[model samples]
Target: MALDKLIGLAMLAVASAVFTYYTIWVFVLPFVDESNILNSFFLPRDYAIKLPFLLLLIAGLGVGTFIGNVLIKKAEKEKLKKSKKSD
Candidate 1:
């Protein structure tokens, strides 16, 4: 619901989609001829592979930072709550 969560989810969705597409392109498309229409949907074979890898790396970093931020916020909130309780 929050913007942070929405952004995180979007990043995750994009990563998943890219990974799925790349998997199919690399593993399944090999069986299809280069002349097939399906081949046009993807980049040249090498770039296709490299691009997805890069996207995944970026998405992974985003997700990791998001989770870290959420954890840190939670910890900060708990610390504040405890300090108030003791005051």
Candidate 2:
């Protein structure tokens, strides 16, 4: 649908903007003078590194939890099936 396409395009645009901002903050700002106005637009330099690492760590934990939950549910289902067969 046209609405879906519009939403997707909007999301893509936002993602692109964030990526460009992050890339500039990480790669370009470091070399810029401390007194420059650009520094005001972003967080401290350390966060550029720490933020991604923290995000990655959180993402890993989320994925691990999801996988574990799925495995637990699967084992429970199998156990139930075996018990039903034994009955």
Candidate 3:
């Protein structure tokens, strides 16, 4: 349960960071002059647009895999207990 909470918090932080970056890149940078130092950190418009979606997809896959593995292990443990009881 603690691990689950930790993973959830970590994912939340990552998602928040990505969303914030995407917002800044898409909404804030356009108004800044091309020569501004901050502009250098900004992604190209197309890639910036796609970044948050991609990050979300990746995070979803990772969380899904972690949960699946945990469920599989639990099933295996239950199976082991049943077999041991019959022995």
Candidate 3 residue pairs in clash (backbone atoms < 3 Å): none
Estimate the TM-score for candidate 3.
0.64
Candidate lDDT scores, in order, read 0.90, 0.95, 0.90
Q: Write the per-residue lDDT of candidate 2 for residues 1-87, one digit (tens) a residue.
A: 699999999999999999999999988998999999988999998888899999999999999999999999999999999999999
Better of 2 and 3 by lDDT: 2
Candidate 1 per-residue lDDT, tens place, 21-86, comes to: 989888898899888999988877788668868989999999999999999999999999999999
Candidate numbers sorted by TM-score from highest down: 2, 3, 1
Name the candidate that leads on lDDT: 2
The list of candidate 3 runs beyond 4 A from truth reads 1-21, 33-38
Native-to-model Cα distance after best TM-score fit, residue 37 in candidate 3, in Å = 5.3
Find the 10 residues in a row with the least total lDDT in model 1: 43-52
Residue 55's lDDT in candidate 3: 81
RMSD of candidates 1 onward, in order: 6.7, 1.6, 5.5
lDDT of 3 by residue, 11-86 (tens): 9999999789878988998899989999888778888748768988999999999999999999999999999999
Q: Give all TM-scores, in the order shown.
A: 0.53, 0.87, 0.64
Cα error, candidate 1, residue 28 (Å) = 8.1
